[model samples]
Target chain A: MSQLKYALYTGCTARESTPELLSSTLAVAKKLGIELVLLDEASCCGASHLQDFDEFLAYVLNARNICYAEKHGLTMVTICNTCQINTAMTKHKLDHDAELRARVNEKLAEVGLEYKGTSEVKHFLYALVDDYGLEAISDKVTTPLSKYNIAPFYGCHNIRPSELQNESNGGENPYVPTSLDRLIEALEGNSVDYESKNKCCGFHVDLQAPETSNRLTGTALVDAIDNNADMVVTPCPLCHLNMDVKQHHAAKTMGRDVELPILHMPQMVGLALGCTEAELGLKHHVTKVAL
Target chain B: MSRKETHKKVTVKAFRFNAETDYLPYYKQYELEVGADDLVLDLLNQIKWEHDGSFSYRRSCRHGICGACGIKVNGKPVLACKQNAMELLELFNNELVFEPQSKKRAMKDMIIDKKDFWDKHEAVQPFVVADIEEHPEHETAMSIAQVENILDADYCIQCGSCHYACPALEVNEDYLGPAALTAAYRFTVDPRDEAGMERLELTAQMGSGVWDCVKCFECAQACPKEINPIEKITKLHNLQFEQKVARSNVATRHAEGFVHSIKKHGILDEGHLVAYSERAAVVKHIPEALAMFKKGKIVMPWNMPKSKNLDEIQKLVEISQTNKL
Candidate 1:
């Protein structure tokens, strides 16, 4: 197998909230003979505050991370969707808009940095298929996940077709082959038929208003469960965090009890890659997926 | 229905950029051989690891827990971990494209600022509001169910995907957005919270509060947690109704007009609707009103026609009232 090099930029959530995904993905990549390059000088990707308010501040903070990547002559590979969007969007803006570029450069100059706009923002999943190749990834799968009935949850950011992302595939395309989905299938896991696969999980909304999110999340999960999905699979930590931990909240608000296990793609891949449950971060989860 | 053959070779054309050299953004094409279940996140990782080391993007917990992976997969905001790759491979089929989420400053490729998203969330004082007298040196006895009831407010990952997809936030940045309001609702519904009234008052005071929502379901659709922010806004509106807060005069007027129309005509009377709405317009334009009347736009005034289901409507209202009681 030809070795591939990637500059891995694990966002804060992977570090603090879903570290298991990072550890497991790294482990799996190593087994596949892939070189995982850590961003030595990387800071926060600045995905958290950019969409809320103060676009300029978001630019400044994210630009710092981008400049670091540029200095290393490496592209970014992120594990979180928000970080990917924020970084990709920032790169898009800095590269496309001249006035904005000039302004951001002036700001970067204050911090002893310059924004020339050249690095490519790529998600880890994209890197997996585009670089390592799924066939290559499949060759390394030692164990099949045929026992697990997995239902994939495609959160809003990664697959959304928006003006910012400039996706050729319009939003709401159900046929797109996401890496997590392919991974599950490759492992012989049961990928159930579910509507609203690409729908929002209401994580951000839940923070501000619980009652509203309860109804929506409740409805979505109920639908997924009703469709006979044994477990909910996702690649984003926030989705896993909210679905696993907040599921009780959703069930409580709706006056019922339902337990759905949330797993990161890497954990699932790790399990399929013959990694033990301990190696996959299964123990760290609030709700354990019975592998 | 006929059977469709699934293709293995999926072409992805992703949007590429950085803050260091590209004057104009372009698309980079990669042919990925994927199974029926691969997600886009896996493909991006493959590309970054092998094809290009300079690809810049952000992600964590490739399972949608942190909301850090939000991006435009097709045009909608989605988490990379939650998405399937074959879905895109077939849809665009050798022409899949991706870009960053809109309305934010990009850092390199996909990373944007996240501080403001948290700031907006924090601005709401997102926590349980307890105004009840505290037990001296003791904790209140609450069941797991009770605690669970209000835990939805605690699920916010602050991914900003909802905020990015929020149309109201797109137009009005001052709006608290869905995630923040969901946080507020967490406290409002808490039985242990004694300061619900205070929180409600504060939320009701903002211009972009509950009243600003046009009832667009975008935020709800954008939420990875399935938190229906629009429903939360409606609940806040109900709270306003209970508190008798008239901050949403337009909403109030619309509701009253609706109620009055239903009350009088056994159905909505477009004529009376116009007259009631005149309260907001301040002046009734006789000519425009007449024109509408002539055009049969005023359903109530003309008593144009009753639905064949009038009894059903009345029965439904009665059932609603009974359920409320």
Candidate 2:
């Protein structure tokens, strides 16, 4: 078998906001013997603003990073779901959208960089499920989590329709796979399929209007809590941000404390890496959840 | 100082990547030792140095302030430095599946391209814009309270989590998004910025601007810095009252209907609320209304119940408005 490896693109959030996920993923990657290379000085993927308001600027920014990965002769692996969506979308746009590709190429030329759009952008979840396989995962099982029952919150961005993603594939059902369920099963935990897994976190509404986000999130959370989810796990930082930090406000609006603890998949994975509570920075949560 | 210590061998499943594929991906698992107080960051660092040096991830400050270390720790978004590995051991019984946040591009193990986040941040024109030029000898021009108003907006660390979590940004591809709107609000309340009117106009024009938001509060929640982009946007909406630029939009219509409904009755009147909001371009759908009535979803006069505390609700709004003025 060929030795599998990839170039790592830890998005800015993981670098500055959620270090535990980055560190934990690296730690686990090392133990798994996966050769991962770090992309230094990686530019932003034009996450929301550039892509939404200024596609040309977004293409320039995302293409530059693609150029970086191409120069290193490695594929790109992303940590943030949004970063994945944006980069993949940009790649899709660059490869298929000729006008956009040319414009972005011009912008990249300014920085002495260019993207061929050959390198593939993969989310860590897809890599884990496809490359490592459950058999390989099972071989490394040291501690069993048969007793844990978890409810996975997929959030909207990572698993929604292709139009919702950066890359819109006719073959891909954006709402198809429940990576969270598979992840829970891999960890030897019970995956409780709940109704709120694919629903929007009301994040956009929250940004534009509080009452709507609050009311909507309140309804969704109440259902999740009612479904008996021990903890709400998601792959997007914004999902965690909304589910955890805004929990108090949601509780306020609903007139009830739906204190569901939010966890990033990497932190949960880090726990299985034999890390302690303090090692994962659990104390920093807006709403404390007893692990 | 005695603390309960549980020593257990834990399993770690990590995602593997290659830059060459056009399709599906998978996982790799490993074994490690976990102790009390060990965080996810500590464990990864240990693995990187002791087991494999090729492991790559980004981290800074080791606290939640930097907003750089967002990843999926066992299927949830988190700051790795802020997460305790031991907590996962207890929460999930010591089994973990680690991956990067799903929607963004993966550079290697835990990183994604952030050029977009930074560019989007810069595109918002994040710097404070003031109307009046500074004079060395001039006394303080802005009020402390006005300065304080923009404080929350100023604290944004540009994590991009809000942008990542934003569904509108995912689909519309033109909205200014929470971070940009919040940035706009920062300038709107600057007390020195002459562009408040212009800024508001620009926001109104941007399809993905404040109007596009479905009000999910996801941005506010995802914000590691607790800037509450929602509140900032709300403040901007309040500024609309002062701007007097209300021609007719979804938000304005909703706000007006809500205010008028409450003013007329103690509580919201479904009939009047719908009728008033019908004036909005987005909400004008007679067929949808007919369908609601067909399905018996719309409540009739006697079938509909009013809020029991109507008087109290009316009194609150009246008092707040009087005091607000």
Cα RMSD (Å) between model 1 and the true structure? 25.9
Question: What is the per-candidate TM-score for chain B?
Answer: 0.80, 0.80
Q: Which stretches of candidate 1 lie over 4 Å from their true place?
A: A48-51, A166-179, B1-325
- Please identify model 2 stretches exceeding 4 Å from their true place: A1-195, A198-291, B1-8, B20-23, B131-135, B138-142, B280-284, B301-319, B322-325
Cα lDDT tens digits for candidate 1, A97-131: 78778776766665566766656677776677657
Q: Per-residue lDDT for B1-325 in model 2, tens only? A: 2336656677787765544552544676778887787778877777678776766677898977787777666555556777778776665556787776643477777777766666656665666665454665675477787887786788876666677666566555666778878888887777766667877776766354566676444575566576768657656655655566544644455455545544443233444554664454335445544443442334454543333334433443343331110
The Cα error of candidate 2 at residue A276, in Å, is 51
* DockQ, every prediction: 0.02, 0.04
Provide the lDDT at B313 for model 2: 35
lDDT of 1 by residue, B1-325 (tens): 1114444766677777765676766778877766655677777787788678887678888877977778876666677778776655445544666777762466666667666677877777777665656566776787887776564556667777777766556545677777788877777777777767776776776455765553335676677677656556656656665665544343344444443333333334534543554454534345544443342223333433343324433332333221010
TM (chain A) per model: 0.90, 0.89
Q: After superposition, how far is residue B78 of candidate 1 from its true place, in Å?
A: 19
